[model samples]
Target: MNVQRGSTTFLKVIIFLIGFAVLAVCIVLLPEAARRDAIERPGDYSLYPLLVCAYGICITFSVALYRVFKLLTYIEKKNAFSELSLQSLEVIKKCTFTVIFFIFLAIVYLRVHAQYTGDDAAGPISLGLMGILATSIIAAIVDVLQKPIKNVLNS
Candidate 1:
């Protein structure tokens, strides 16, 4: 039990750091990216809205991470099979889908912009594709976990 507790604590700390890192990146890098894009391609404000969307998605990601941390805390307290844990998982899965939706929007925006400007958008488009793939997987895993959690609750 002690070892399990320690591991969960470690995982919680890591999740906290990840949330922090996401905030830090949005704070420090996103504005710079927006500015750089504006300067490099004058009159092209398309990327600005995409950056905003990315920040919104980051907010969803943070919420999901917070839910994961809360779930971990419940697990540490041996309440993993409780209704609260199931709720957290449900929220996390919703957040994942939200992020995936935003990524899809970003991809569509980038594709249209690239077609208009005749620029190479493959790199950013590929990144968005990867995000969609990853979040879809996360959602699937969360759904799978939910089934077992439901069984546990019923038992």
Candidate 2:
């Protein structure tokens, strides 16, 4: 099946821009929370891991945005079911892994940080991470499984 390059590219560009905007907001907002000292007890500096996870998540979104731009340009010339979309999907699959990894890292950071100060915000952050991790995993699985089915149905 032929996908309309103009429409698909526009759609992907919109999504990419939204993601980039969100990441930018997160980068600007996270520093306030991250600046708090986690030195409640000896060796209780879980803040570093939280900062690292935040940075990782931001970087992952940045890479995904770059990939989306590349995919748009590539799809403009090539067929929908061509090798281009497959490669783009591979990049998306890797990003999903990164999402899952960062979510898990965030969960760890939140859990450890909460132990020292009993911060109320940590619980909600951990819950959010769990939700994101689950969604990313499901999306990745669907993308991986749906491709073969789509190809077969089209053929």
Candidate 3:
């Protein structure tokens, strides 16, 4: 029990750090990058809308992270197969899907904008594609885990 408690605490700390790092990037790095892009390419207001969408995705991701933290708490309490844990996994899966959808939109926007401006869209598009892939995998894993958890809860 002590070992499980320690491991859960460690996992919780890791998740907290991840959340902090993501928040820092969204708060500090993204705006700076957007400002630089705006200055470098004057009169191109496309980035602002992209930034807004990205921020919205980040907010959803933050909520998902909070749900994950709650799920961890449940696990620490030896309630990993509880309905609340299942719910948290469901919410996390949905959030990952949302993130994936937003990344797809970002990819489309980047492709269109690149065609119009002749800018190299490869970097951003690749990044968005990777995000989609990663989130999709996360969602799939959560879904797979959910079934087993549901079964356990029922039994």
Candidate 4:
């Protein structure tokens, strides 16, 4: 039990740091990059839609991260097998699904833009595809984890 608690504490700290880092990247790095680009080209805002999509993904990602952290807290509190943990897993799965939806929307938008602009949108499109794939996997894993919890709750 002591070892398990130690591991949970370590995971909690890592999760906290990951959340902080993502928040910093969204707030500081992304805006600074946009500012730099604006300085270079004052009126070109083609990337703004992608930035909005990124923000959408970030919001969902933050929610999923919080849910994971909450699950870890439940584990530490000796409530890992409770309904709250199951709910956390369900929320995490939904968050991943939301992220996949946003990525798919971005990919569709990129394809449409590329049709007219003749620009090389393959890079971002591929990234969006990868993002969708990753999120789908996360959702699937959450679903797998949910089965036993549902069984436990039912029986």
RMSD list, candidates in order: 1.4, 4.8, 1.6, 1.4
Q: Which candidate tops lDDT? A: 1
- Cα lDDT computed for each candidate against the true fold: 0.92, 0.69, 0.90, 0.89
C-alpha TM-score for every candidate: 0.93, 0.67, 0.92, 0.93
Better of 2 and 4 by lDDT: 4
TM-score attained by model 3:
0.92
Q: Over all chains combined, what TM-score does candidate 1 have?
A: 0.93
Q: What is the lDDT of candidate 1?
A: 0.92
Q: Candidate 3, 136: how far from true, in Å?
A: 1.0
lDDT for position 15 in model 1: 98
Off by over 4 Å in 4: none
Where in model 1 is the C-alpha error above 4 Å? none
Candidate 2 clashes between residue pairs 3 or more apart in a chain or in different chains: none
Better of 1 and 3 by TM-score: 1
lDDT tens digits by residue: candidate 2, 1-155:
35676687677879777886867667676675655554344465556677787778777767776776776676666544556666666776787678778878677667666777777666657686776867587566748754874685468
